[model samples]
Target: MEFVMETKNINKYFHKPKEFHVLKNISFGVKKGEFTSIMGKSGSGKSTLLYILSTMDTDYTGQLYLNNDLVTGKSQRELSRIRNKNIGFVFQFHYLLSEFSVLENVMLPAKKLGEKSPAEIERNAQQKLDMLHIGHLAHQRASRISGGEKQRVAIARALINDPTILMGDEPTGNLDSQNSENVFNIFKKLKEEQGLSLLVVTHDEDFAKRTDRIVQLEDGEIIAQ
Candidate 1:
């Protein structure tokens, strides 16, 4: 089956740190509409692998594919366009602009894409916020909301582009247990209700267990899947 995202013989190195090999022969696939998680302890290359997969770090050896199209060796401009059009990202921190309203934050990606008119983008952004149960907070300043609400707004922003896959790097690391569960449920809802593919890097064992599959990494190598 064609994967939403795939990597082959992927390897990465850190030059300034005395030529340290950060990732080793990593190969994996995230199927369409599948929910997958990557788990490892600190320094295990979990985040490193994620950055490579996300097309944000191109200094690696291997082939990367998104939506069954090879992305390896693409120019930076092409990769940037591909990333913006095909991938939605959420990080451990909700990096929303504090001064922007939640709606504006959610509309930013769609605006950058420039595929839809401003009015249409705003409508779509509001729809995403409503789907995440945060529509009521759309006009609120991002800085004024609770942490949980802000994270939800971040998720809404990620979904605004209607990406091929949603990727997260320890997306719930900053949340309390309840909020973490809420985020997990939101991911689950996206997968079940919208058939959205998701791949997230997380240290939480419980979170990994709940995903359809877990890719376990150790010492820069994929040890299990």
Candidate 2:
């Protein structure tokens, strides 16, 4: 089967206060349309591995491939372009621009990508918000929405670019159980109906259990899959 993203023999280290290895020979692949979760205790390098997989951290040794393209040694500019066109990320914190309207926040990435006309971008952004059931809040200030609504908005924003893969790092970590379930249901809906691939980092067991597969990490190495 083809994969949306793969990491082979990935290794990472930190030299800040002292040299410390974070990720060790991490390898995995996220299949097309598969919903997979990465789970590990705090400081297990789950987030560190995710940084490398997402192509945001280039200070790692590995063969990183996304959409069948080798991105391991790409320049920052090239990687940025590739990421804008291919990957969507949702963090534990919804990094929405508080001053912008929900619709604007969603349109930001699409606008930066510049692959579509402004009017087209607006239409696409609205469609994403509607798909997430937040179209009515599009004109509202991002700071004014509820936490759950904010996350949905964030997901909408992440989808605005029509990325090949959606990656989440503790996407529901800030939500209450009820809201977390809401977010999970949305993810499931997208995977089932839209056939979008997803790789999520989560500590919530129930959430991890619900995914198609679980990749567990311990001390920066994949311990189970």
Candidate 3:
């Protein structure tokens, strides 16, 4: 029953042309080692909710907790450090550095954290790639990889820091069915074998249904969980 992440009375607003309420008092939690999916129609604030949970968006009103630590109202510098150490992100786009080798791309996050020696980071990066079955492409330029391979590389990069939770924003949206299934299998393996907590925002019904739980959002509020 331990929660890895939790949000209490979360509310968000967007002030552009006019002020509009986006997220409405969302109270949610993701348990440790739980694989949860957030699903809804476009503009349901699913992505917005993910941003808040990921600690990338602080303009909301809520109490956010990570690893049982209160993270709300923390300074940006502290939040950044927490995110790098505890949250892994995989977006719809791979976002790999085209010019960098696959190994380098995977190693970039650990290098930024500067918690490990370069030699150790390299070895860890290679192990991540190998775990994903992409170690053979370690020396290849990221631009040379196929779309599916690029996504796998992105997953490897997200895992380099040993994050407490892995969050994905439509991770398989750009992939074909086969590759999408491959990514899901990888996620399942990560959860089953490594006990990694995961929260993903996705429009794919099949993908959402396959997860351990699904939180359904509608009109900026969670309608079902």
Candidate 4:
């Protein structure tokens, strides 16, 4: 299997004359299509570590590479393109555009990646929504859908890019138990069917434990891998 992401001696810190370290010498590699979870208590650096891994925050020490390419020194324009094309992100909040319909929400990323005719984009968006079992909600305003439906649309949007890797910072954070499980099941399906790597930051131990591999972090350092 291909290595989806790798880091060596990666460290992150917040400095203000006095340095405050948040991530301390962490290293790990994730394989393609593998599901891995990073777990820790509050302020254990779990979220901080995830941000560095996902290419969202890059101001850190040590080598951080995505798909074997060193991500340092890339221009903002270059990085933005990379992010749009190769990686997909789902945050704690379903950042759906309220003004757009469900189909439009899923098409936003694809539109940014490359320009396509509206008809074509809609076709693609519908296919992705169908995959997530939310095609019926395609015409509804995002604000009108339930939280679970909104999250499913977010997942569909992420998948529309056909990203090599998907990163989740508590993707199911706001959902109830049933909805959370449904979202997680979608993640599993993506890994099995699309060979997509996943690195999710979750406080839910039950969810973390279900992943194929677990990386435990505490005090900014990786305690176990």
Candidate 5:
């Protein structure tokens, strides 16, 4: 089967205060266009594994492959480029630049990528906003939007580069139930219609249950898939 992401024998450690094994020999794979969730209680190392998977944390021993390319041990610059082109990230906080217009916020990543002209970038960003049903808010300042709108803007920003994989860390944590459900439906639509692969780390049971697959972690180990 084709895999969008795969991890093999992953292990992590924490030093400074003491040498603590935070992740132990974890392994998993995400199929192309799959919607997967990693669930765990506090201190289960779910976020740590996510960072490694996202190429944000390389201080671990394992092999990581994204879109069938081995990404293990790549230099910081190389990893950054790969991440910019192939992966999108959303965090618990929307992290939108309050001073920027919603459209500008979405266009920033494409501008940094520099693979498209300014006009192309603008059109693409606006398209993403439209896909998220927020195109009408494009000219508004990000700070002026509501919580749900901001989250949608953040998602539009993440999609600006047309990444192959979209990763989220507690993406719905800041929203109310209605907004969370909206976000979930958006994800479902993305996976089914857009063929986007998603890996979300969430503590919400309802959200976890709805994903294509759930990988459960406990005490730094993957207990179930």
Candidate 6:
């Protein structure tokens, strides 16, 4: 199977009064269209690893392959371009543009990348929103929507770019059990419809169990695959 994202000998460190090693020799692979989760305790560097895999942070020691392309030496400009075209990220806090409506919020990425015309982007955003079953809420301001609905809009936005891999960093961290389940259901919908590869970082056992594989991370390394 083709891998959508992979990391080999990934090591991330931070400098403060003392150097803190956040990720240590992390190596993993996400096959195309598979849903995988990274589970670890707090301060276990799961988020750090996710950011590296998603190409959100570049100052790490490792070889990362996204869609089989080596991403380590990619220029900032080129990395930004790759991230926009090939990757989608969801954070614990749904960072919806409060000023924009749900439809417009989902279209923001395409607009920033100048990937499509306004009318076309809007149409495509609407299509994804509808697929996520949130089309009726498109016109509402992002702040006005419930947490569950906001998460849905965020997922639709992530899908707007038609990315090959979607990475979520504790996407359900802030929601209640009910809302978390709802957010997770959207992931299932995405996997079924698009066969999109998913890499999720979470402490929630229930959410992790829903994925095709659960990887246990301990002390910045993969102890269980």
Query: Which tens-of-lDDT digit does each residue in 1-225 have in candidate 4?
Result: 568788899888899878999899888999988999988899999888877776778798898777889886677687788888888888899899999999999999988888677788889999999999989999999999999999999888887778888889998889999999998899999899888899999998889999999999889888998
Worst 10 residues of 2 by lDDT: 46-55
TM-score of each: 0.98, 0.98, 0.99, 0.96, 0.99, 0.96
The residue pairs in collision within model 6 are none
Candidate 3, 1-225: lDDT as tens digits = 799999999999999989999999999899988999999999999999999999999999989999999999999999999999999999999999999999999999999999999999999999999999999999999999999999999999999999999999999999999999999999999999999999999999999999999999999999998
Model 2 per-residue lDDT at 115: 92
2-101 per-residue lDDT for model 1 (tens digits): 6999999999999994999999999999998899999999999998888989899999999999998999999999998899989999999999999999
- Total residue pair clashes for candidate 2: 0
Colliding pairs, model 5: none
For model 6, give the RMSD to the true fold: 1.1
Off by over 4 Å in 4: none
Indicate whether candidate 1 or candidate 4 has the larger lDDT.
Answer: 1
Per-residue accuracy of model 5 over 1-225 as CA lDDT, tens digit each = 999999999999999699999999988999989999999999999899999999999999989999999999999999999999999998999999999999999999889888999999999999999999999999999999999999999999998898999999999999999999999999999999989999999999999999999999999999999
lDDT-superior candidate, 1 or 2: 1
Clashing pairs in 3: none
Count the clashes in each prediction: 0, 0, 0, 0, 0, 0
Model 2 Cα lDDT, one tens digit per residue, 55-130? 8999988799998889999999999989988999999999999999999999999999999999999999999999
lDDT of each: 0.94, 0.93, 0.96, 0.88, 0.94, 0.88
True lDDT of residue 167, candidate 5: 96
- Judged by lDDT relative to the true structure, which candidate is superior, 2 or 3? 3
